[model samples]
Target: MASGPSDTRVLVVTTGGDAAGEESDVASSLSAHLPGQTVVRSSSTAAEYLRELGPTVDCVVAVGADADVVWTISETDPSIPLVVYGEEVLYTHVDAVIPSTASIDDLVARVQTEVSESRETNHLEEVNAKLTALSRYAKQITGCETVHDVCDRTVEATHDALDFDFCVLAFVEGDQIVPCCSTLPMDAERPIDLGEGVAGRTLETGEPQVVADMQSDPDATFKEREFRSVVSVPVGDRGVLQVVADEADAYDEQDVEFLEILAGYTNEALARLERETALRDERDRFHAFFEALPVPVAYVEAERSGEASVREINAAYERTFPQAADALGEDAADAFPTTGERRLVSDRLRDADPADQQIERSVREAGVEPFTVVLVPLERIGLSASGYLVYVPGTVPSDETRTGYSS
Candidate 1:
């Protein structure tokens, strides 16, 4: 990637009364040392030289040029290395300041070194820019909350930051690969299955597909025949990403590496979204089940002092135990008809080891039917509650009549 003499172009700007003689000497010496380089000589001030700047100009070698002009050029395009050949040593912005009386060999050597360094600096800057762009794209994809949003953003970011004529994000749905999002609209949405096109083949093998010239390769069966360069990267187990360009050898291993990083981000985001959705669904199902139960149920917790308290109660519990309707945050001992039963329940739960600990006992009150009560321990699940209390009507059942409560 190094720039040779043919690729180098030097803009020599001459200034002051003594500039004419010095500019000729400098230009002649540069031509003799670097024969193939294009050396353009111009006499102008800082403002005039700015207008003379062109795309082909690689480096600016100022001979007796005004100090202000040199500074202006350096500031304007810092990438363009500035070499000043003059007597006054300002040390402002030039990359190399050679004395007016310096030998031609010394001047040429300094210019050559500055040009090479400038080329290296420019290459590093380009690489840093790409890395910054990739980082920004990753952040954008992570912000998306849904699978569809992530897929869409992946296409947009890849197209904007990398070299590609078209891109696609397809997910595996059932036995077919479905197009979830793409950079361009298709005449007809074509679905690919296992062992079919590049995308499908990549998905089936769980590996990346890179085709240098899709038209010439028999294995390349992608719908788009115009694309010469193609890449398909699997997005975990969910899907695959495909990018295409019209020119031969448009992409290389480095391009594939970059796209793979993007694919990894997309997969992680999709997995996170799926997990969160599952949790939300499970929580809703549990809430509905608790609300619809016919029997009285209450969640009771044990404190460090060995006291039991009611943490939550269902609608049925509120109706059957009207006196303890406002039992939330209240001591279970106070909510119950008597203190003895609450203490007995807490001690039994504290001593139990299993998560689904259950005990049955008869209830005798001043009024109403003598109900059978059951307490279930919930310690194994890491909940704060010691267990839940359930009340079943009638006398305590025999072994054949009893049905164990499932945790």
Candidate 2:
């Protein structure tokens, strides 16, 4: 069996007749085979001893102990490996049972094997728990709506999820990598060059870089020279996410993998923000053009209720028909409260084609003279939503136009 790590702690519990002698013999045998290992001999019951030592005990060896004691130890701490070294036939819960006739070497080898396997199992459990937490953090990062929010959450995840002390998220701005957010205060004016440091190298190669000992690395270019280890992963082509520590070899391949997962989440959030920003810019441009037109214009949308509603009206439209300002969000039929005028406007908009043709018709609102209105289909322009634009020419003399509509 493998000797395993030297830090293993074995608790030898001796019960029944010859307790002192049994404890001494077991301690000596374990110490002889496993050098630098800790052996604690206890005359107390198995459950009591385990309760006192808690998780500090890696393995327990019971000498001349009964089935009740072995069962109690298993119930107290199932994680602690139990080895019963008595001659009694034990149907109890125990990791291994050695015959009383067995030699000292057999006992030592069994304890070593159990210790090694126990450590491996515990390490795997810890890693799996950390990964589960990182998965939850990734969901929150993806839901972030802005680039700054994404960077903040990314840095927070480094500390909360991965347990890193220092982290920085930097984006490419021109030829320099600008720090967007960091756990430590960073100089915003003096950013890192796109090809200078560990983060720079990650961005350049589009891969993760792990430096076990930055002090000894010739390519290390971070301002904080006190940090001895660093891991940098690229956030797509947009930026790099980096974490550092004061201890050398603080990060392993597992640490790099976790950071890469977080970087991927940040990339998704940034991409979402980019798309939203582009859509907002497009809508702003469209609104500017709508307002700049000299003629009065009103945007109408077909609601789910099978009625056309006036969604928006330009400044010129509001000024020309002052009563129409209150008509915003009202049905088109109510906006033009003239006899048969509602059907006249709705039919023109419904029949308007996508070929960019403007259908002209004369319509009269209550208390206002008849005016020529143009129905232009807005679906072809790809506005944020499908709608129609109502354009009224400025042909009515100022004196002939009414200031308000009559109910």
Candidate 3:
């Protein structure tokens, strides 16, 4: 969507002096540079006038006659940015401070810049509003819990946010368009492998294609009578953001940009969701060790005897030693009821080489199963010494270790 208005109805306040003529002329000239019915609210005292006009005005162009006026206006509102239009200009307070005699081109450019910034701010607010609306749909997306959820949400949000008719989000599937999400007319199949769709072609080209009329255009692939316009915006350098609309020439530069922004949001959120999914998978796999094994599967760190304590131990350890969960972050001796077991492990760790050397040994502790630890130094594997892997007999099965070598 093209962002909200700027350079529109601006209340111009010429403060610190009674220069009505100067302020009016300046406001008139600046207002003329912009399009549409421009309203110029001229005043001598800006602080009082802005209070009167309130938030109905878009921006305030203040012509500060002296240095003191800049401070006064700046302190009073600061929300209505002051554009100094006098010989003696104060640089500190206003959004932009420039002398009135400065090049007309420069003045116009700054005004355009402010307009552009306002547009960006409006665009961001719109996106925020969309996200707020999408929060209610979180449960729907969350329930899906796959990449499919992300795709569905993307289409639903885009359709609602931008008021577009048909939205299609497709992922890469070799040479095909694997439809992940869509607000198409009817019940659409998931994982669309139709290689001939516009989405797939867009992904193959790695560029967005804007077709105003599919019926007239030979490049577009669709029931031309069904949709008049289409925009195939590529996502994350790979995926596709295919938007079809009923209006002829519906996809413009603005549409492309807005869809691109939506794609960017989808990419970021999907990446985060993917990472979270991976973490959950890792956690599930980590717990699976207790299914068939002898020793308790505990991840332990070889903490410095005096500097640190036991950082973490797994559920297997908690099962083997009923108190293992509560023992975390405590000194090994404090963690285990037996002092000899703690001394043996701590001493071995304290004297052990930094290299991840396998130390296979039988140990007996109170309320715990027989344990054999594979003291693999994690720092060698680019992982901080979170801990070592403890394989207790009947709790964790044994796996081969590459005797001693770093990649």
Candidate 4:
């Protein structure tokens, strides 16, 4: 067992006759140099004292110890480093091979350095584990689709990765930041305003903020909520994600940085969801207008070859040409009465480029009345295809043409 950073234990073994005679002086020098440390001395030939104390000792000092004693120390515990004092010697287990003439200060410095290094190594391992958990959480949140899923995952992942007791993900709705997900129960009826608390301040400035001691800080109004420490990270311009701890000064700069990384992942996921929602709404509006149009209309998937297939036909199209409904999914050219009319329409609407706007072509379908068709490429309205919106307007050809679509 090794002592903690605050304290250390050093075991001194005197092997030869010369070392045994100077054991008291050597032990005193060691104790004086290492403050807040316990020093033990052993003179037994078999080094039984060293054996008994090896488990608890942090560092071992051999004063002119013979080969047998050194070998015993090495076999018992190779990890507990030995600082051999005497003429130049080499041992696999010995940490430092200093001459007998070397001062006590040299030995004290070596022991303290080794003990401090051991503690630091342990600390780094713990930090590495925490970072691994953070990475795993980032990967888990990528599959989330909805705003609710993003917010819930953000709060849950933070708790799982950092062990933060309380966490919340809020979104900017109108003039206020509203809590969408939280580890604790929230009052849905109440809204948290921007700039009201640490989280609010972070949202307003688009910066990460930390309140190390919420209860004791004069600037903090959130102390009424009873949290002692708080770290708030902004999620783009969208909102803020905050974590609260019960203990005062629980969070530091490292905690704030980790939360910032989490917020970055959350921001990207939320932006994608928002775009999808907007597109869905736009598609719904387009479907309503497509159904309500009074004119004979055929919405086709336009091709670079200027040939289009009728994806959907309105009621007016069915009334005008009842055969057109049964002819759904067929090329618009085949649905027309004459191949000449198909060539004419295709030529006028050339390549179905939305920038070319609307094109008109007149056609006489055998005995049927001659009518003018207006072809407007649906690509202008953000449809998937370089398609056209075909409608016969008032049975006449006109110079006036509509260029842009308004939603």
Candidate 4 TM-score, true structure as reference: 0.62
Report clash pairs, candidate 1.
none
RMSD of 2: 7.1
Question: For residues 112-199, what per-residue lDDT tens digits would candidate 2 score against the true structure?
Answer: 8888888888878767987888899889999987777888888889888888888988899999998888886454224878898887
Candidate 4: clashing residue pairs, number: 0
lDDT of each: 0.70, 0.73, 0.59, 0.68
Q: How accurate is candidate 3 locally (lDDT)?
A: 0.59
Ranking by TM-score: 2, 1, 4, 3
Q: Output the better candidate (3/4) by TM-score.
A: 4
Whose lDDT is higher: candidate 2's or candidate 3's? 2
Candidate 3 stretches greater than 4 Å from native = 1-145, 172-175, 187-194, 278-283, 286-293, 300-333, 337-374, 377-385, 389-407
lDDT of 3 by residue, 1-407 (tens): 13345425555566424676766667677767754334454344666666666455555566645666566666666655456666545455767756777754665567557656765776677667756655644545444456766787778867777768788787776655666777775544355444465665676677778888878876566562478788888877547888787778876686787777777767776776777788778757754653344555444454333533566665555666655677677766676454334543454444334222222332335433434344433332222234454543432343453233211
Supply candidate 4's per-residue lDDT for 137.
77
Which ranking of candidates, highest lDDT first?
A: 2, 1, 4, 3
Residue lDDT tens for model 1, 100-217: 7888789788888877787778767765776678788888888789877898788887877764558888888888888888864575246777567787778779889898888987
Each model's total of backbone clashes: 0, 0, 14, 0
Clashing pairs in 4: none
Estimated TM-score for each candidate: 0.66, 0.74, 0.49, 0.62
